[model samples]
Target: MQYAQKPELYATGTIQLWEDPHIAKGMLEAHLAPDNDAASRNHQFIDRSVKWLSTLSPVEAAPKVIDFGCGPGMYTSRLAKLGYEVTGVDISENSINYAKEDAVSNNLHINYRNESYLELKDEGLYDWAILIYCDYSVLSPEQRQTLLENIKRALKPGGKLIFDVFTPYQYEPLKESHSWYAENASGFYKDGPHLCLFSHFLYEDDVYLDQYVIIDEMDQVDVIRVWDRSFTVARLQQEIESAGLKLSAYYSNVAGDLYNEASKSLCFVVEKW
Candidate 1:
């Protein structure tokens, strides 16, 4: 009997580190790994948010919660266990697939949707919305405002929306130019074990750029680029107000401390009118 041919596995999209689905999936999976330090930090942040949610009186019905950019459903599973009806929305199909599989393995029920935040509108369907892990900063200023407006519409009256963004201080230590070079037999591999030469630069305008060249043992090579933007507290606050949401609180740390200039993250709780 003849066997069917298997499909080739290769990076898709712009080949940039941030846009390449394969690399993005790998990075997200690593961060969501249970034993990873980043995962531990994320859990602590979620715990603190859950604690705050606990203080609110139980609604007549369980509040519907949406996790924006919920990569692999790490926090989605936790929120489901807390008795909240959880829905995780992600732009990445690969991420959503992995999240669904992970949720099934854990015997947890979560609604995982492959959709962008821009597509989520206030259908009066959710009581709480979350854009955790500094996901809000992932969008441009215009896109951010659009997302907030959609979240506002999705919430019921007095519903809550919470999100985090990196502060201006996050760019303080990053230099304008940095580079690295390495070589090895495995270095020529583009998608496998390889030596990588990398360079990164942080601009004064709150944008960061990185470029990487991977070389495998066979001398094969590929290049990847990445860019990220940071937001200021004032700008974020203005956007929140423009969305018709009231900023209930701002925390500098996951532990609910007041925001300060030195804080790397700006966590906000906003209530929809």
Candidate 2:
């Protein structure tokens, strides 16, 4: 058994699906279908976003928007059609390519960048920055800080940055489990016949780790550690304040329902202070 690399902490040493060709190709296609991925990104949910996000948008002309982790440009093209200047960014080369092609085919003017949003400098001049689908919960503490600061610098004065995150209530009763599958013709790692061991770990009040150990037919091992960092409402607010951002809006979900302890998912809309 071998690891791609040593993890920095819990699950930092892994090649995510975003960087894997075999996985990202399937992911892009899955993104088109409603509720295809583990995450629920159904068409109805996405279409409703226009109204949900509009609560924070300007009234007159469309606001300049930046879609962080804009996967396959799903929301990017839709937002553009709704009359907003949009820019989509993702880490996957395949996803970026597909987004770019779609934009061209549709004759929509959207700037698509194949880059890591975490490494993005404070170089954007936009009215809104959105990171939907609870992508914010996956980053480590340090990365989350960097992301918040970067978004703060990128937004114009009074600009709003919105993103979703999972609360600790949503991840209680930490489950340590495992699953396996025999080599099949199709899967994320489709190189050849392989043994797959999938497992998860939860640290007390810390992070949820989705760890994978795969052995290919050639006896090659691949270890993947995907960490999902969760937060409590109070804790998240404090972190946002530390980043020099003001939490102006909080919701149970993108649907705009009021958030509370019972709400597993929370949407936060912050302003650069």
Candidate 3:
């Protein structure tokens, strides 16, 4: 296999990792994995996060909530259980189907949409919007602007958007690296034998990328790129403000820990301005 030069920033991958059928299956497994934070945070942390989020929109208020990237409805289901009107949007059909099944089994009424949140269209429909699990850090600047605009359109006037982003502290030890592996059986990357070339890149402005090039026995190749952009409070505030949103409050994390410069992540509640 030929070595690939580092890609330009925010280049689209050959496949959308979250929506690819095989990868989606593996993603669902990772999300449901009780012990790992590979796809979603551990269940215990989720419980705490959901509880803290509830305090933001008490059941007595009967608030309408929209959860972006609601993988398997982990947060949406919990919020629904608290009697909040919940809508979950995701790009993965597999995850949405699983979430729908679980919601039905529990007799919980939730609106689950299998679509990209970047294209969110409901205007002035929700009181609270959540993009948890640090998903906000995955987008490029342009994509982020679009997402914030879409979310702004989706929320009521003065409505709030709650999300988290990693900080430089989270990657203080990250370094540029490259490696490869061969998988002969059904695995995270494929259902059959394939060769995988992996690279980890660190860029200026606290940006990082995990790039994977997968080649099957037939020589078909697929490239997957996962980008993360860490943020400082000032940087995050500027980005939101450019989209007509204002930061209302911030914490070290979604769990409501006090914000500090050394924290690995920063969570914010921003209002449509």
Q: Who wins the lDDT comparison?
A: 3
lDDT scores in order: 0.69, 0.79, 0.91
TM-score of each: 0.78, 0.92, 0.97
lDDT of 2 by residue, 1-273 (tens): 223223456555446767888878777778877766353378778878767787668535437999889988878888888778888888989988988999999999999999999988756588889998888888877888888887888888888988888877777776877777787655665566777887777666567887778777777777767778777778889999988999897888876778887888888888987
Q: CA RMSD for every model?
A: 8.0, 2.5, 1.2
Q: How many Å off is the CA of 83 in candidate 2?
A: 0.6
Enumerate residue pairs that collide in model 3: none
**What's the residue-level lDDT of 61 in candidate 2?**
43
C-alpha lDDT (0 to 100) for residue 62 of candidate 1: 44
Which candidate model has the greater TM-score, 2 or 3? 3
Query: How many steric overlaps are in each model, in order?
Result: 11, 0, 0
The residue-by-residue lDDT of candidate 1 on 170-244, one tens digit each, is 777776554555653323224455766665655545866555666666776666654556777777788788878
Higher-TM-score candidate among 1 and 2?
2
Q: What lDDT would candidate 2 get against the real structure?
A: 0.79
Cα deviation of 221, candidate 2, in Å: 0.5
Runs of candidate 2 with Cα error greater than 4 angstroms are 1-8, 37-40, 59-62, 122-124
139-210: candidate 3 lDDT, tens digit per residue: 998889889989999999888899999999998998899999999887798889999999998887888999
